[model samples]
Target chain A: MRKREPRVILSFPATVDAMSMESYSAAHGVPGRLIPLPTAISAGCGMCWCAPITDREAVERAARDAGLRVSGVHEMML
Target chain B: MIYLDNAATTLHKPPQVIEAVAEAMRSSGNPARGAHGSSLQASRTVYGARAKIAALFHCPRPDHVVFTSNVTEALNTAINGLIRPGDHVITTDLEHNSVLRPLYRLAAERDVALDFVPADRRGNLDYAMFSQLMRPNTRAIVCTHASNLTGNLVDLRQVSAAARAGGALLIVDAAQTAGCLPIDMEALGIDVLCFTGHKGLMGPQGTGGLCVRAGVEIAPLKVGGTGVQSYSPTQPAEYPTRLEAGTLNAHGIAGLSAAVDYLNEIGIPAIHEKETALMRRFLRGVRDIPGVTVYGDFSGDRAAIVALNIRDYDSGEVSDALAQDYGIATRPGAHCAPRMHRALGTEQQGAVRFSFSWYNTEAETDQAIRAVRELAEE
Candidate 1:
């Protein structure tokens, strides 16, 4: 048996920015996955990136290096 | 104008929805795929939202719910992913363009046969008609849970039972009923449930998804990078990642999650009771008006969407007057369901639609009734 949890999530100002972050992170070998922004954060519907909490810095750096705009970052037990 | 066309997109979202989007934008970082503190928080937020939606739909597994831009995209994903060329699909006349257009396109291009089960004059689906329409080539039956134009709720249980008997998958478009009605995906036997977040869900626009049943494999509509499978060129074969490609609408999801929470806290049954009561009131007021013709069954289970027309008054004219003169906003015309209007014998004239939500008060319905009464007199 195995267990799973979502540790890190990123929010973007615009859908394109979030999309660019996904592209940049993937191209640069960052660890995370794009998901619909969670309800805990908002009741509106949109997408966000989710990953293990530990990979935050590398992914952020990669997003910045790729010229992708970052909105907000959070750590939660999911 | 006083907003009344909620079926198109709900106006005035709950305060929590706006706050959640802002907070996510301000605090959370890239989720799931990231490893930092902010990303971890963001991931948790997304998971929490998924759980909320799963709870809303009574889905056993949140992972089965895959996000999309809107119900159209969700419907497209389910229809295109599941039906191959030469496969048969059974649908209904009450379907919106979202469901009709894609199925039509697939029929023309992919050589699939689409059978439409016609709705009766009252916008009710005849299950017997649906059973007769089934064929060996019928691999799936996609139907809207409610009519967007007339607010007629289809008997999903009957349809699902038919699908089960025929060994076909049942896909339901829950766009109008997801938040306004009580829907249990597992209990309904619905193989795929497509819904939008902006309407009854109380979320902002640009949020929708498909709740796919376990063991059902639908091909990905778009393929790119899923943040996972950095090594694989093709899309990954997982529940959500398999379907979700490219960057998701994080801000929208945050808002949607908040909307779902608001609905949950308020309780869907309560919302349903409130909206339906208002609908009944509105219908009763207009039912006896000499010049007004109301569509759909007033006695059965349905959403709050009401379609009507004043005698000798064009639908668009009434809608425009409702907006310009009375400051009451409503949707006019075919309501993106031309076939539905045609079936109801109102295609040429269309109809003025007043779709209600929890935000609408009894006073608003009274005002709408008065406005219609005035229009009828004119």
Candidate 2:
């Protein structure tokens, strides 16, 4: 079994942005999943991207390469 | 602007809802499926949420609550999983499309027999008629806790009694009533309870689940890797993992947990009292307005939803006017209960709905009253 660890969580300001991140990352082979923004991060609600810590460089590269604006990113155990 | 479309979804969630969701993302990993530290923490967070939901609904076991994408999926899972071919299922006219659409599809595809108990002109169901509809193959009785259109509440005790007597399981769609109304799963004999987090629970959209009582099993609607028993091609046969076959909506659950915590802190009784009071005030203000016809029972049994129409205006027109001119947001048309509207004789011109929530204020109710009165006069 692959060991899983909570990585830095990134939240976009809009639903479309988060969705775009998903599309961009998948096309470029970036590793992450779009999930509803975790509650501990904010009481206000929307979706965000949960990437594995090991894939941080690839995700960031994908975001930059795809010309997607990055949102707030915080490292958490989740 | 006043927001009275809570039946569709609650507008503003509690502050903790956001905080909890963020915290979950920061601190937790995939729950109950791993042995690593982060995974264990994630598992604990999920279990804590399950306990919170169990406490809220008074479920005997926390494991009984299974998460889904939304109430629609939950309803589909329960209805489709339980009813075999040629089985009979009893439902009512007050159901939202989430319940009705899936059952209708099952009836056509799986050959299940479906009987709908007609509601009164005001959208109240007659339990006597429902009792008579029970047949030998009646496997389940599925009904909404409150009508999404009219906000009329069914007598669950009566329905539970009837289902129990007929040897049928009772499924209640608590999308509108879970956080706003008091419900005890064990005491009420509800074998299956479906709830949406976005509505009364005040969480974000895309979060909902079903609470399965002991001895009830719902097949997985979609099969995939549940991060457990990955070697096996078939779905896991555990309580929640059996049905939750995919990457779980951990973020939604995190927000849902916060929403549930907010409700618990304020208390359901207090929230209900606050909302029902607003309902009464709005009812009183709109009842005597000329050309305004209200739907649903005015007797306070319903939740915060109310449907009404201006005498000569189309529901859409009134809704647009309310939004554009009055700055009040209200839902117009069938409200996803087309059959209920048909039963209420409002199918031709669906009524406008004003659904309230705990965050709604007395001043907002007054604003809605003034707006409707102005629209009615015009």
Best by TM-score: 1
- lDDT for B257 in candidate 2 is 87
Candidate 2 C-alpha error for residue B274, in Å: 0.4
lDDT of residue B255 for candidate 2: 88
- On residues B1-378, what C-alpha lDDT tens digit does candidate 2 reach at each position? 788898899888998888888888888777644445666556556656777888888887666778888899999999988989999999999999999998999899999999999988988888986679999999999999899898888889999999999999999999989899999988899999998889899987888888999789887788876554445568766666678776677777888988988898899999999998999899999999989999988775779887999995799999999999988899998888988999889998999999999999999999999998988887
- Model 1 chain A: lowest-lDDT 10 consecutive positions: A13-22
What fnat does each of the candidate structures reach? 0.00, 0.00
Q: What is candidate 1's DockQ?
A: 0.04
Interface RMSD of 1: 12.0
Give one clash count per candidate, in the order shown. 67, 21
Error of 2 at A75 (Å): 36
TM-score of each: 0.83, 0.82
**Number of the predicted model whose DockQ against the real structure is largest:** 1
